[model samples]
Target: MTDPPKAWDAELVGKWLERRLAAARHDQAAADRRGYEARDDYDKAAAEEWVCRALQSPDCTREQAALARRIKELIGQDDYRATGIYDDIRFERHVRGHLRKLAKMTKANEGFEKTLRYQ
Candidate 1:
């Protein structure tokens, strides 16, 4: 016969799920940083424009660009903490933050998109 699962075990399982999600995000974030860091000036600029595409957030505003970047970092940080990956991971908030900041700058300079991917 099988025994019933304990509450602590269930909690442990929940923690494991959170940690897994965070670890995956950390890995993805690291890759994104490397990709951004490896580009030349013009490529980096264009890549920055692509990065803005991730903002797939409707209502994403020029003024909210910097703030949006901040929020994205916070959201990622919360993911790191929740997933217990912050200890072994050195997820630089500035990587994503700066990338998004550039995107925001581009949008602000170019004027808001009327039909962005998110729109």
Candidate 2:
């Protein structure tokens, strides 16, 4: 016979998820700031060199090469802000959606556990 399912504390799970979300947000913000600062200090020759290096790398993805080309274009136009980077908002939304799904699963499991205990 199969063993019974384990019980989980919904409150504890919620708290853990919240902490993870906060950490992810903080990390994303730090990365965005770093990227912006790096772009500010970047030059056309540096961008071109990076693109050349990327093109030479066998492991570089098409998306990465495309991004490198875009960076070179931005450098030529003197438009650092148009780098088309920073997916923090999208990442946060995905994390929140995943957390919500986990919360729902936890709630369902808690209800099942309560039913099992009472029986």
Candidate 3:
């Protein structure tokens, strides 16, 4: 028997990809602007102030998330710095690399190379 009609045309796919690429480029520019804003001297002080204010929150709400929760226990018990932020709030960059590697290994991608071939 003859094959059924295609659900999607190749031309439609090309147009869709072109639009998506254009939108992605626009988003990249906006992201760069945000980075520049963060680097501004005024923004630096604001970031520092936010860190100082959240100093009491364990981890500065920073990288050591689980450990940071214990910070509250130390708040009134002993002499703790009232306004001090840990150097890094979210995490060390290495952790991100590890997470990305794990995700790539575990995530299903029809186009990516997998340990064993499967669609």
TM-score of each: 0.24, 0.32, 0.27
lDDT of 3 by residue, 4-115 (tens): 6333232332333234334434443444466654333322233323322333233322223322333333332322222221223222222233234323322321112222
Sort every candidate by lDDT, greatest first.
Answer: 1, 2, 3
C-alpha lDDT score of every prediction, in listed order: 0.37, 0.36, 0.31
Which is the leading candidate under TM-score? 2
> How many pairs of residues collide in model 1?
2
Candidate 2 residues 42-115, lDDT tens each?
32223222233323323321233343343344334422221333343433343344334433544344422322
Which pairs clash inside model 1?
18-83, 19-83
Candidate 3 clash figure, as a count = 3
Off by over 4 Å in 2: 36-119
Q: List the residue pairs that clash in candidate 2.
A: none
Worst 10 residues of 2 by lDDT: 110-119
Model 1 CA deviation exceeding 4 Å by range: 1-39, 62-97, 100-119
